[model samples]
Every structure is written in C-alpha cells, then in structure tokens.
Target: MTAIEIRNLSKSFGAVRAVDDVSFTVEAGTVTGYLGPNGAGKTTTLRSLLGLVTPDSGEALVNGRRYASLDHPLNEVGAVLEATSFHPGRTARDHLRIMTTAAGLPASRPDEALDQVGLADAARKRVGGFSLGMRQRLALAGALLGQPKIFILDEPANGLDPAGIQWLRGFLRHLAHDTGAAVLVSSHVLAEVEQTVDNVVIIAKGRLVRQGTLAELTGNGGGAVRVKTKDDFAPALRAAGAEVEEVEPGLLRVKGLDAEEIGRLALDQRVLLTEVTHERSDLQSVFLELTAEGERA
Candidate 1:
C-alpha cells in the first residue's frame, strides 16, 4: 500500500542544500501531513517526487517507480505545488483542459474535476477573478482531472477560511476513504494540519525529525501538563519531584510528570481536584523542538 517513497533523496541549489538525504514512505488510503517551517525543503522534496526537480543523489519514487518511469505520470500521482500555477485568464474548465489533455484524459473530464472541488458553479469565471482559496481549489481540481490515485498537495489550506478548511479536510478524507487515494498534505499550520492528518512527516533544515502516526508522535511527546488544584497543591507537587511552574492563575506546568501520575499524587496529598487534562504536544511545539534539536546537533 506504499504509494510514494523517497530514499536518501537529496537536492541542492549550487552550494546550498535544499533537501538533504530525505526519506519516507506514504501509504494509500491515508492523509499524511508533510510539516515544516519555511525553507525546510518540504516543497523541494515534493517537487523531487514529481520529477520537477531532480535529486542530486538517491531516488524519489512513486508507486514502485520513479515519476518519470510511470506509464502515465498524471494518473499515478497528481500534484498541486503552489499558488499561481494556473492560467490567470482562462476559465477553470479551460485551465483543467490543458492539464487533462497533457495527462491524456478526456478534455470533457475537466467538468468532473471542477465539480469535485465545488467550482462547478464558477466554471465559466476567469481564473483571474477567483480568490486565493478558489484558485487553490481550482489547482486541486486540475490535479484531480485524471482521477489520480495519489495526491501531493502543498500548503493546500492556505488562504482558506474555517469553512474552506473543513471542506478540504472532508474532501481529502473522502478521497482516501472512498477512492483509496493516498494524500500528502503539506502545511505549517499547526492546529489545522494537526487535526486533519492521520500521520505526519516532520522535517527541519532538509532533515527529517520524525514520521509516524499522530498517536505515536504526540501521545507521549513532552509538553506542558495541565493540572487543577487548590493553591496549596503547588508546594505539594514540587515535593513530589515535579518542577511545577505556574502557567496561569489556576493552571500549572508540571515537568517530569505524566497526567496519571500527577492525578494520583494530587489525590494522595488530599488536594481538591476539579479538573485534569494533559496538554497534548501540538505541531507547533513539535516543530520547534525538532528544529532546535537539529540546530543543536
């Protein structure tokens, strides 16, 4: 079920290494968030997978073959790399027309794609008139024109409102669940991508920090621990070998303590406990931690 694979893949711009020895696998029927900050070589890596940028060393493969080796590349892997990849003056249908024709899909299939992205109502409108969110949808429609089985989408939710993001999440989930397509949704939006993705591929300075299921990555990730207690609990928590830092008037950040242990200790101390919820490590904290780790190394 592995749909895309990058093995020791690397790319550089003269002396600057944009992507360095990156490797990961994306499986079908899953939505993986390829996450990193700016200039993390995320875009370069995706480009390499699509054969838009040749890796300086190693290989980038799609469905057991390099993108260039695929019998019909568009049908195997569809990509929307960035904004403004569309023709400004052409209608959405016309824009997809060129792409479908290149993919050897029926020119008439553009309508199907347009409809899939909910752009059917605006099919006749010039691309120049579309908002940034609309243009993103159109680009995705273009990528899907051939009914591709894999999607490589970069910053797909940028410029989208809450509703648009919801629509995209549901659409992507549907693509994986219904058609069994594998989706790689790249983004730096922590909370949003954190909610949408099933697994994660995190990179920093062209090096991967972690790649795994959401539970595996965040379940035990160290971050602030939420605690509720009377004011006296602070001193008691410190006595329990946990470094308790007041996060707010009522909440505390207890280091070296998991939520269950903290709760048990609080109960042992006969402290009144009204609420206890562990603050799960979010994408932002994970990114900062990984990036800093890379820097220190």
Candidate 2:
C-alpha cells in the first residue's frame, strides 16, 4: 500500500505559487527521497501533509486518510521536520520521556527510542551541552517514540558528521527493509540521498519534475562506455554510430552503446582496448539537469 500520497496539491502565497499541482506517492517498505532546489515548495508540501499548512487545492494523504483525521497520528506517522526543540537544562532522557508520555507510549519507549538512534550513551547529558548531531538523534528518538510505520524527515543529515550520516543511512534502510516502514526524507544532499533512498521525487518551481527509482531516472541516454585504447579510436567509434569524446589522451567516452558493443566494435576495427568501463549518471548530475531545465522553462 502507498504510505503517502499527494494529488494535484497546490499552495500559494499571495501572488506567488509555492507549490503547483505536485503529485507523488511513497510506498510501504521503501525509502523515498523528496528533493528540490531552494524555494521549490518541498517543505510547504510536507507541511500540507502534516496539517501544519492547508493546501489551497487538492489533497495530501497519509495511508489514505488526511493526517489530522488519523486515529492515532503519532503511532501511524513519525516526523522530524526541523531541529529538536529542547529545554537547555533538560536531560536527553527526560526530553524523550516527556514525548513518550505525551504520545501515550510506554515509559520504556524513551530508552528504546534512544537506543534505536544510538543516543543511549548520552541519555543523561543536558541537551544544551550536546553536539548538533546528538540533538538531531534526540529529535529522531522523539519521532520513534511511538514506533510509527511511516517516517517523514526534512534535511535529516543537516547537522550530522560523516559517521553520523552513515549511521543514519543504515538505520533508515533497516527501518524500511526489516520493519516494513515507509520513509520520506527530503534533503539537498543529492549524492547522499542517492545512496540512501530506493526511489526519488524531484520538484522545481513547486511542481514535480521527476519521480522514479534511481535506475529509471538515470537510465536515460543508455549508458556511457569509457574506453582506454592503445591508439586514438574516436573516429572509428563515431563511425560505429556512437558519440565519442576524448576524456584524456587514449581515453575516450563513448555513448549510445553498451560496453560490450564498444568492445566488439573496437576489436572489429583492430583497435586494442586496455580498459572498457560502463558508466551510469549519478543522482547529482540528473538532479542538476532537471532543476536547471525547470528554471529555464
């Protein structure tokens, strides 16, 4: 079942349209990246889903129902939209305990949530003394207090160091893979999101520009073949209906064919190839291209 759905959702701020006819879905047991350039209406869309902002038209649904209409909202959806707002003097454990109680979860939930986010060791530390990464973990712990089936996070890796980011990636993957949870994470870090999410929804000017699995989105233009030949083979490669460009001396980037085809063509032409590697478009390049196109439109 789809965990999150947005259909023709739009929101306007006076004369400006922050989001326009955005539509997408995030399925269960998957981690979907929600991405866009600044002012692309990503946060506004998320707010609409959470009932923090009312959409001017259309609807945003969670598990087929409006977020505010859910019987047990916290138990059904866990969200960390921004940094955790904690009392400076409050201990991490106390902060989580308060949320656990408010959410109607058991007292033991605070510790479990802390352990889930690897913040157990800092349970007694005052939040004011905690690092930015630790505070992020605390916010995540609060979200997990009810063990929600769906998670919505915005810029989750903002304050995380390299190690924390890696840990978060693994934790999010485990949530979707092992626990059958649905995760929608929004971030500007396309490279990290590419590595972490199963699928992506990219927006620009508040409208969806692309939505698909990583492979489906980046699989266009077939694949590029990087060939290292003993001699210049650009002319021969171009003759074989491939677009060839010399990346470096003796290294040619060939498009419009697979590596095997490139190898066969080179062999047939008596060009000895030292290396032939297939290359796929990374998320960063694809994202930049889509957003840039949207701006030009």
Candidate 3:
C-alpha cells in the first residue's frame, strides 16, 4: 500500500528552486529514509506533502488525496518537523493533553503517547528543564497523540545519545514491521539510517537522485568486487563483459563478476592483484556518490 506519494513535485521560492520535479512513494509497513545534505530540498518536499507549503506544480498526496482534503487529517498523518516547539512552562503531559484536546482525541491519549515514547517518567517535568534528547522524545510523544498510521519526521534522531538512538532504531522498525504503519524519516545521519530504514529516497540540488530499497541502494544483495592491482586487468575485465570502474589509480570496482571469477581472470591475464575483495557498498558511500556536485544530473 502506498501511504504517501509525491508526483512531479516542484516548488520555488523566488529564484530558488527548492524542489524540482521530485517524485517518490512510501509504502505501508515500511520505514523510508528521506536523505540529503543541508539545503537539498528534503524539508521542502516534506513540507509540501504536509500542506505546510504549496507547490508551484505537481501533487503531494496522502493515501491518494491531498492532505488538506482529508476529512480528518490528524487521524491519517502525524508529522514532527524540525521546527517543532513547545511552551517552556508546559509539562510534557500538559503539552500532549492540549494537543489531544485540540485534535478531539481522548484525554488518555496524552499518557499513552508519553509512555509509548518512553517519556512517562518525565511526564510532569516542565519542557524548559528537559534536555534536548528528552525534548525530542516529548515532541515525538505529541505526534503520537493521534496514533496515526503515517509518520513524517524530520531529523528525528537529532540530539539523541547513543542509547537513545539505538532505541529509536528499534522503535521505528517495530512501528512499521510489527504494527504495519508507514514511516518517512528525513535525516542526514547515514549510519543510523542504514540500519533503521527499509527503503531510501535520496535527493540532491532539489532533484530526486535515487529511490530504492536499502539493499538496492547499498548493492548488498550482489555486491561488486574491489580489486587493487599493479597490472592492468581493466581490459580483460571489460573484454569479459564486466562493468569496471577505476575508482582510484590502481583500484577497480568491478561488477557483473564475483571475486573468484575476477581472481581467475586476473591470473589468466598475468595481472598481479594486491587485493581482491567483495565490497558491500554502504549507505554513506552510495549517498555521497549519487549526491556529489560533479555527478548531479
């Protein structure tokens, strides 16, 4: 099930094109990581989807309808954008209580959400005294007040400690894999994302650069072989119909052939390889490769 869809979405602020013809979908029962560098139109695309910003062209749909057109928006989508703020004097429970009341949700929802986000112990603490990580959890608790099926979170892991981050990883996965919700998390933390996300939507310079499952983006299902050789094996590898890239002066990233095959071919061609290792591309490497300025479309 497609929970969120952005079709040909483009938005401009004066002369700056914040988003340009970017499109992607988030499926139900999966966590999609929306990743990009600073000022890469990630937030703009998300804002457009939440109806916080109107697009110049294209569509941002929630369950096949515009967000504003939904009869009960809060019951369908829960968003925790970067600019989330709370009254300094309000207790965590109070803040959530206010939200539940405003959204016509049950009063018990505040406590339930606080417990869900692990903020039950601090429910009575004023927002001003909470640490950044605690505040982040509080904000998340507010978003959970409606118990919506779709979550749109921006930089959700910011300010979290190592343990908190680890907990968040499991929390998100449980939400999607266990309960069958759809989650879209936008963040620049690549390592954490590599572990937490099922799918990835990457953008660069206001353009959709890549979108696929974690395995597809990372090339983990059938990884390439990285060969370091003093002699030239590029010609032989190419001749054998292998896609070879000289990633460095003497280092080659060879696809379409396994390490054993490459080693045999290298020996037959009299190429002395110093290294022949299968390389599983990580999210950070692939992200940098796709979003690098020189490689942009």
Candidate 4:
C-alpha cells in the first residue's frame, strides 16, 4: 500500500500559489526523491502534509488518513525538515533524553538512535561544539527516535561531507529495504538523488512535471551508440536512418540505433570499427532540460 499520498493539493500565500494541484504517492519499502527548483513549492507541500500549513484544496494523506487524524502521529511519521533546535549547553544525550521522555518511549531508545546515526561517541559532548555534519546527524537521530514507519526529510544531506553523504545513502536504503519504511527525501542534490532513490517526483512552478522510476524516466529518452573507427562512418550511418554527430576525431555518436545496429551498418559500409558502446543520458542534464522547458512554457 502507498504510505504517503497527496491528491490535487494546492496552497497559496496571499497572491502567490506555492503549490498547485500537485499529486504523488510514495510506496512502502522504497525511497522516492522529491525534487524541484527554488520557489517550486516543495517546502510548502511538505509543510501541508505535516499539517503545519493547510492546503486550499485536496488533501495530504499518511496511511490513508490526514496527518492530523492520526493517533500517535510522531510514532507513525518522522520528519527532519531543518536543523533541529537544541540548547547549546546541553549534551547530545540530554537533548535526546528530553525528546524520548516527551514521546513516552523508553530511555534506552535515545542511545539506540544515537548509535544508529554514528553519533554515539559524541553523546556526552555539548551540542554547541558539534559541527554542521554532527548536527545533521543529531536531527536524524531525533527523527528516528519514534521508529516511525515513514520518513520525510528535506535536504537531510545538508552540511554532510562526501563520506557523511555516502553513509546517509546506505542508511536510507537499509531503512527502506530491511525495515520496510517509506522514505520521501527532498533535495537539490540531483546526482546524489539519482544514485540513492528508487523513484523520482519532479516539480516545477509547484506542479508535478514528472514521476517515475529512474530507469523509466532516464531510459525513455533513448540512448546513443558511440563508435570509433579507423575511417569516418558518419555519412554511411546517417544514410542508414541514424542521427550521427561527430564527437571528436575518429569518434561518432549515433542515435536512433543500438550499438549492434551501428556495428552492422559500419561492417556493411566497409568501415573498420575499433570501438562501439552505448551511453545513457545523465540525470542532471535531463533535470535541467525538464525544468527549463517548464520555465519556457
């Protein structure tokens, strides 16, 4: 079953429509990337889902009910929208202890959550002494305190170094794979999301422009066959109904045909081929093209 659902959701701030008829679903046991340019209404949509902002039309549902209708909402959904606030003088353990107590969870949960995020060793250190990466981890630890079934994180990798980002990628995958959690992560880091998420939901001007698995979205754009031959085969390949572009000396990028087809055409044209391979379009380029098109429209 779908863990999170937004149906025809629209929100406005005076004369500005932040989100307009946006709709999407996040399923269990998978990570879905929520992506959009600045001012595209991603934050507004998430805030509406968490009941921090009410939508003007439609609804945001968590497990078939509105977030406000849920019993023990914290235990059902965990969110890390921004760097969590904490008393600078308080130790990490103390901060978590307060949250654990408020959530009515066992005292041991704080320690477990800390260890899960690799912050166990810093439990006794004051929050003021921590770096940005450490604070990001602490916020994530707090989100996991309830062992919630769904995780909604906005820019969770903010302030994380390369190593920290890598760790988060694996941790998020583990949560969805082993624990059957539904994760919706919003970020402007397209490359990281391209590698980490199973599916993607892209928005522009507060409307959903695309939503599908990585393969579905990327693969549909078609692939190009790169070939290197001793002799130029661009003319022959073009005559065979393939779009050919000379990438560099002795190299050609062929579209509307696969590597095998390219090879067969080269052989028929008596071209001595040295290399042939297929390359898929990168997600970053695709994302830019999509958003740019939306802007023009």
Off by over 4 Å in 2: 221-223, 228-233, 248-250, 256-277
Note the clash tally of each candidate: 0, 0, 0, 0
Candidate lDDT values, in order = 0.84, 0.88, 0.88, 0.87
Higher-scoring candidate on lDDT, 1 or 3: 3
Predicted model with the maximum TM-score:
4
Candidate 2 per-residue C-alpha lDDT over 54-146 given as tens digits, one digit per residue, 9 for 90 to 100: 999999999999998987788999988777578989999999888777767889998998998898999999999988898889999988988
Candidate 1 residues lying further than 4 Å off, grouped into runs, are 229-240, 246-252, 263-276, 295-297
What is candidate 1's local distance difference test score? 0.84
Model 1: per-residue Cα lDDT over 1-297, one tens digit each = 579888998889988888989899989999999988888899999988898888999888888888877778877887887878777888888888887777788877889888888999999899998999999999888788778899999999888889999999898888887889999988877676777789998887888878889877886568568786655788888888888888777778888788788888877888777777777876677667876786565
* Rank by TM-score (best first): 4, 2, 1, 3
TM-scores, one per candidate:
0.87, 0.88, 0.85, 0.89
Model 1, residue 142: C-alpha shift (Å): 1.2
lDDT of 3 by residue, 114-170 (tens): 999899999998888888889888878877888889998888889889999898899
Q: What range of 10 consecutive residues in model 2 has the weakest lDDT sum?
A: 216-225
Shift in Å, residue 205, candidate 4: 2.1
